[model samples]
Target: MRLIKPVEITPAKLISSNVPETDYPAWLVSATYALGDRVLLDHTIYEALAAVAAGVKPGEEVVTPEAPAKWQNRGMDNRWRMFDDKVESLTTNPGTIEVRIRPGAVINSMALFNLQGKSVTITMIDPVEGEVYRKTLTLVDAGVTNWYDWFFEPIGKRTDVVVLDMPPYGSADIVLIIDAGAELAAIGHTVIGAVKRIGTALYGTSVGINDYSRKSTDEFGNTIVVQRSFSNRAEFDVTLDTSEVTRVRRLLAELRATPVVWIGEESYEATILFGFYKDFQIVFSGPTVSDCSITVEGVI
Candidate 1:
């Protein structure tokens, strides 16, 4: 029942990057905009909502009372899609994509979802001690069960990566690098935060994906299928000290609608999730121990 309470990495925190933030033209305060016109501002795309809007700065939303509703936010720009919290929207680049961050606050864990790269390199530098941590991970899964799969099947790449061993240093500058050799490098969503251990994930834990594809049958018994993305889901029980019951209740209360990296057991990859929970309950049957059951739903 361990989880990551991620800290929001504002756009300003992304101090440097190899990728450019030029998906659309920069918003001009003097330029005139017609209805449905789009411009980029602060790495976000905003669409003009008026027939003709001039000297109106584009922002995250239509400022009410403060300014006229001239622009409506569409979504993140192409280069900023990975930090948008939506796993289906990918941030892509050729050969490699690199970003540097100074979180200021201490962060010990980082989770990568929907990755499309051959390898990843993470480097951390302390202000006084210099290079503190460096690790490179190959993205392919090497475990093969059968001879046919080993010879005939293409190499399987694990899209999800969880790094739970970062040194807890607030001043360390962390650099994330994704390499795809000669092909494209892409990432869907990334989570960097500190971990919170709730309890152990007992047996009978379940993991699956919720499909959103459309299926219809014609009168003649023919089937039509419209493929769609899916969201990963999981349910598990936890065992924690009875004294932490109040703390767990409060933590869940604060993270109700917020999305965080949920890591049930560090050794179990399927137990990790980055999403919200629909419902949870706590039960106490003894004086020294308590139990918790939580159901989590992930964002695509």
Candidate 2:
């Protein structure tokens, strides 16, 4: 089988720095600035680890959501999944941000295994104004399953999709969990065969030439050609068997040359299904060595 690449996210680059606090209410200004920076950082780290887990490059962009297309129609009855719900609250405590689901809205039978670790809590408080906000907590380790619960069913059977959202400028803490059963496959087991990043640009400038004839027109037409650039970063993981290594390498080369659409500026979460296999082989390379690693445990 070909090697599968994981999804990835880039580090958040600082967009703004030091500013005077006099522009707005002390609490509002502090909260906005702190939360904005935290959001960007958390997003960047999530993408990076997610991509590494999938065995893809570190800079690949992926949208963040609960599941893939196949799981959208499962019959869970729209229960309130803990991590799937978006939470918002205003308080003064920066210790922990918590939310309670109106118990029973979620079907316990449908729960699955927890895939990640302890949530990373980001607390933004305006000391002057006494306003505070929190967001989806970050996990310390990769592949920590302790933080979530999972549920599953047999193959060819349908599963329900949990609809979760986070309120703007609000705090959210999510735990990763899964539902497993006979015939139910862990969604992360499906391997990514290959992944690539691509971009294009204009090549050279045009030159002007004079025509000899009286009916001559200026010969200044531009010679435009397509120029391409590729990310130096790439990654791969071993699954299925060791012989699959060569095939995975070839797949990586192919992905490097594939064309990709430019989405401009956006944030996305991507999930990969690994289909019942545990042991995996991964490799990565790029202009800058990535701070990437794998987490096999259930808790971060």
Candidate 3:
């Protein structure tokens, strides 16, 4: 069957320290009636757990079923009456139903449903008290789309410890329908620690500066060094005149540095030169030359 929605689960609140009874409910013990009849309880404990995990809040209503019933043949008056009666009976008398919350914990939401073609029951045994809350539901041939939904009460102030059991059926399947909210709640707890750590780190580093660095090493294990220095005031124009000027130009181009020439105020411009290496002579002959420094950067 396809799941239409996700389950919700929330933290359960502690109600009492006393444990429940030990006996399993009669409905839970004998899932099938005489003549091979099936009794189905629409919801399961696992589904309730899932709802709680998904964040179903207290006082929220969720529907469950008592057993699976046929949905077709609703036009028959007798079938309709049977269906209505069964729904009312199950809703009114959830025999010996009790919710026990574990101490210091939260109570998640509950799940209820009907099982098709199977007799089912629920028995909760509080290990501490050895008391059991037993419940039984019979399967009926109700029309399709007319199944009953059971609403669980709010996870009030008094609930501690929960134990549930279901009897085996020879020919019917027992399915657990859960609440979307409770499922999420259960998963959230599993990763809560990691989420908290990441949140802390993000908050702590919000105002810090981030530094970036890059380095290259040669085959001989020697590291290429590049440096940049800024100079203010002195300026000179240098033109290469030697035969090795081309090689020097190539080397300069490979150095990965920008060359800047400062003219009169508001007339400054920069150019990138490259492809020079070995035996290059640059002649400096500029009227605005007195004392200037060359800044070099990048891997050599």
Which candidate has the highest TM-score of all?
A: 1
Candidate-wise lDDT, in order: 0.86, 0.23, 0.23
Task: List pairs with backbone clashes in candidate 1.
Answer: 88-300
Ranked by lDDT, the better of candidates 1 and 2 is 1
Which residue runs of candidate 3 sit more than 4 Å off their true CA positions? 1-110, 141-300
Candidate 3 accuracy as lDDT:
0.23
| RMSD score of candidate 1 (Å) | 2.5
Runs off by more than 4 Å, candidate 1: 34-36, 60-70
What is the per-residue lDDT of model 3 for residues 1-300, given as tens digits with 9 covering 90 to 100?
A: 000011122223222212122211222332223322222122111112221222332123354485222211112121111112121112111222222333221211112322122333333334454433455443332323423322333221110111122222222212221112221100000000000000001111111111234457999999975543322222222332344344444544443332211111111111110111122224333442221122321111
* Model 2 segments more than 4 A misplaced: 7-177, 180-300
lDDT of 2 by residue, 1-300 (tens): 111232211112112112111222211112222212211221222111211222222233343576222111111111121122111111111222232221111111111112222332222333243334444333332333443422332222221121122222222212222322222222211111122221111122111222223332346864554433211111222222334434544544444533211111112111211111212234343332221211111110
Alpha-carbon TM-score of each model against the true structure: 0.92, 0.15, 0.15
Estimate, for each residue in 124-240, the C-alpha lDDT of model 1 and write its tens digit.
889899999999989988678999889998888878888888889888888999999999999998788888888888898899999999999999999999999999999988888
TM-score order of candidates, top first: 1, 2, 3
lDDT of 1: 0.86
